[model samples]
Target chain A: MHTAGVTLQQVAQQAGVSLATASRVLHGSGSRTVGEELRRRVEAAAQELRYVSNAPAQALARATSDVVGLIVHDVADPYFGAIAAGAMRAAREQRLMVMIAATFREPGLELEYLRSLRAQRARAVILAGSGTADADATARLAEEIAGFEADGGRVVCVGERGPDLDTVVMANRGGGGLAARGLWDLGHRRIGVVSGPAELLTVRHRLDGARRALRSLGAPLAPDAVTVGDFTREGGRVAAVRLLRARPDLTAVLVLNDVMAAGALAGLRDDLGLAVPDRVSVVGFDDVPFAADLRPALSTVRLPLEAAGEAAVRLLLEPSGDEPRRVALAAELVLRDSTATTVG
Target chain B: MHTAGVTLQQVAQQAGVSLATASRVLHGSGSRTVGEELRRRVEAAAQELRYVSNAPAQALARATSDVVGLIVHDVADPYFGAIAAGAMRAAREQRLMVMIAATFREPGLELEYLRSLRAQRARAVILAGSGTADADATARLAEEIAGFEADGGRVVCVGERGPDLDTVVMANRGGGGLAARGLWDLGHRRIGVVSGPAELLTVRHRLDGARRALRSLGAPLAPDAVTVGDFTREGGRVAAVRLLRARPDLTAVLVLNDVMAAGALAGLRDDLGLAVPDRVSVVGFDDVPFAADLRPALSTVRLPLEAAGEAAVRLLLEPSGDEPRRVALAAELVLRDSTATTVG
Candidate 1:
């Protein structure tokens, strides 16, 4: 029999043995007692046929491994770090080991890790990052995840929803609107925005929400008021500099993430020689660990990052029905010293 | 043939086969083939006497896996996060996947992870944090690592040296001295120190260095001037508060780490209502990513954390003789706005 199309049933048939006996012999499970002669015949048939079972069948044959896989865009980023920490804590409680892989924001790498985790026979796999803007990458990921699930692997996402997978999503749009409203309430009419990559769903949702808030306040944000950069600190710095140069009249600058906000703070002070709140107020999203410790202390939106991670793991570990599980978390606007009443 | 104490040579002799043929048949290496009858005889003899192979022997029999293991103290800590990022980057370039496990500062967990990695047959294992204070933990780690190495697996340590393993040592003591001297040069004599867990080698090295600096300057650190905490932000806050309450006459405070320094700054401002520099200067070690952006901009000792991580991976990947490799990195003192000359 050709190995490419060989099956366990065919091997069992050739060996003149039952499927269970064949499986027990092939999987090296010693619990069943098969006569030496019969076991040898089954093994010989399997070797001749070169049978290869799918991941699920192979997993069932072996002792189930107690390892869970976690994939993040960047583990060094405090945002993802906080989430991974929570997942690690939960895994420890359940006596499960976590094997984390960093994709570094590359969608291709994410898919590669999923395949690797499947090969490792991990009990579950959690992808923790923003959904990519690449349609092909997204489609491939969806297909891969579907195949993985079919093979008895559980998967959960901790950031934006991806192709109907179980997800714990943050309220990016609402948080953006809340941030804008908070700045507007501080008497800041003229504001600028430091946005992340245009292709990212996070940037789009947040920007849309900010625009909605501006419209509701009867002071819509202009096209010229927005500058985009990578969702990173250096990107934030460059965008902030561009924003200051483009519109010096802006009283406050809203950053999409806390890491970027830190960069903007540096840009305002080092590059523009501008005083925070006095010259240009600053606000950020995602109240990361260091946000409260920043010099002026950041005024931002707080997301339950750790809790989101724990929830994602819980969704994976719990039994699921047909419908994909969805858990949406709310973001709260936290007022700090980074924003102040507009100076006349 | 009795499987116990039955070496492969003895099995080959009993089966009337060459040692090479016995190995090829036993390992199931398809490159070379033997007669079906001969293979059956070898199999029967092996099954009649159960034999167990070492990890390397089992690994060699199977296709080599493409995964490297990284063990960290905590993924949530920025210091470890930065190192993990660098290692992840390097692993990507090599087309090898990284499997990260966080011990959460538990030595027993660290040992458990080592065993897990060995079971996975990882290409290499990197332990990326401080060694435990427990002597037994250290001894067990050394034994495990030695066994792993004996089984043809490579191991590297990234923070403090663990046993005689290859290590990338940070200049914790020298950095501590640098931080203290920086404060001393600023005309502050009466100083207080916020230390991490006293049992940690890092804490001991840094504190000893700071004491050395104080003594060299003809001003010894008073026994009452030191307060120990968990090497965390909250611990820093509590330690800072205790230090201030105990040593009200102090003019400057040196925190062992930047994360803790951020807490000390908060404590000085919120708990004591004291003006930084004018009332009490502050300095710290390990200029993490947010150090330069902290409100007053942290004055700290900058360790090349990412570079250290990269170096650790390089050491593991590169071939070395029986002698262990050692790489020591320097720390630079960064003077920022947080520290100033004390007022009369």
Candidate 2:
């Protein structure tokens, strides 16, 4: 009655040992040990029978499985892809298989996935999605997380979600400041901002930092100078066009992320017929892969994406103390060919 | 007694129903039905007790699981990311969780991941990595696939692996032909080929297709004109440098992939101080997301990567017949600004 090839019962019968002894020798958790002769017999019998160990049964015998769940907003996005790769690398070292689900920026889907991971008895879950500003959704998510933790599953969020949860926080606001200040130092006075959805905490923090930095430099960013995109390349392009059309006096624009920055670069040259650095300088955040491949290359704030993912996984595996743990990652601005002194 | 919160037995007791009735009601495979009154009581008791269903136990009872495995060479690569996004989209529709493993191009790691997925009794596995030319490794992989299928697990390969298995084959050779013809039509006769590892079947097929296409045009590709890279941007840059130093007469180069083509562009302009499409022309395969954002854009062959991923998942969910299923995808040439006519 084995759906997974030969069963352990057959192996035990062939080896002439008790079922407990056969299991102890084959898939034991290392706390128990079997005699060498018995273990050899069991292993040989397993090979002869071509037996495949049932992980479900083993997981039932223990309390949990080797699987860890990783939830992201979009796996196809290079930001999430880099993080998943790093998380997978760390999971490999822990001998844990990672099950990933893309929520596509839907808060409902994120909650559903957490419940599913909890049901699967996943050892831990890494929440790599951005925090939504919806209070109701956040409260519901916090409750669901409590349920998951109650069931012995650990969770580590990659960004700011809520209080009392382990998190690997990126210096998003600081990065925004760096992007603005870099442009300011290049003699760019009238600078515009291209941002993503205001509902995202990341977007809010980054915009706040840019506005503050610009205000201190005596060129306060006007509300009309900021245009919102959907955090996509196309959205960035559309927003850049709208912003530049309205504020023709601006000499530079600060994009919230690299993807949008790439779009702004295209819009500035192809749409508006303006040369970069000579007509308009651009700065972007997140310095994702291929940032340097763009025309004139991109000057962006470097966020250690892979390291953030690795840190989240590490926090999940570490022992929990009385308080939630936080790992702060710093963002640095990298100057490239995209930015230059603004010429009149 | 209940590691995952309240157990089914406790719910059964609270609902005043038989253990069998509780099992048939909650987490049932839908083959049996319980009385409406009993189902209501069970639902109420489950909510009150905060019972979390055990997926492992459910999998054991059903002899299968709702989890599918996806194996890739690298997840950080945008090519794989696009595919994964498609696969995840399809999996979400099917209400299945996908566990992804990156083998990092290691044959041993691929095999190990396969066994792990099998042990977990995953519903199916999608092999998205390129096939290796190693005979021993292929044989071993085939044997493992045989064992996995025998245990009631479905296997679907994304690209060419071996015979007698379902696959969603991308037109690698045809794509290569398209790239070569696109360049030939532009009057580039003295052409060079930049490629990845020769051990990959994809690389071999692509190179063969280009060689055949060029041969038909009476400009046969010479062995000395082809350079091998590690399928990375840096590798492509170094290979382009070496090729130009050796064969200065070549007016164009066909890069195997877009990532490498990006590097070749940088090398041609920065290292060699040559103008694109003026002093040299270049063509790449796989019109990835950032192809258009690159300077002068990239002329390449477009492969429907996301559709390929969706098709694999669809194949896995469909019932298997006597004959193995195959889905062939066509690759088309996309002309951008990267290539131009050869000038003296």
Q: Give the per-residue lDDT digits (tens) of candidate 1, residues B119-199.
A: 565778999888757787788888778766754678898877564678888898899898888888888889889999987
- The reply for model 1, stretches above 4 Å from the true place, is A1-64, B1-60, B342-344
lDDT against the true structure, per candidate, is: 0.82, 0.89
> Which model scores highest in lDDT?
2
- Tens digit per residue, CA lDDT, model 2, A5-124: 678999999999999999899878699999999999999999988788888877877878899999999988888888998899998998999999999889999999999998899988
Q: What is candidate 1's CA lDDT for residue A324?
A: 79
- As for candidate 1, its clashing pairs are A295-B295
Q: Report the number of the highest-DockQ candidate.
A: 2
TM-score of each candidate? Answer: 0.81, 0.97
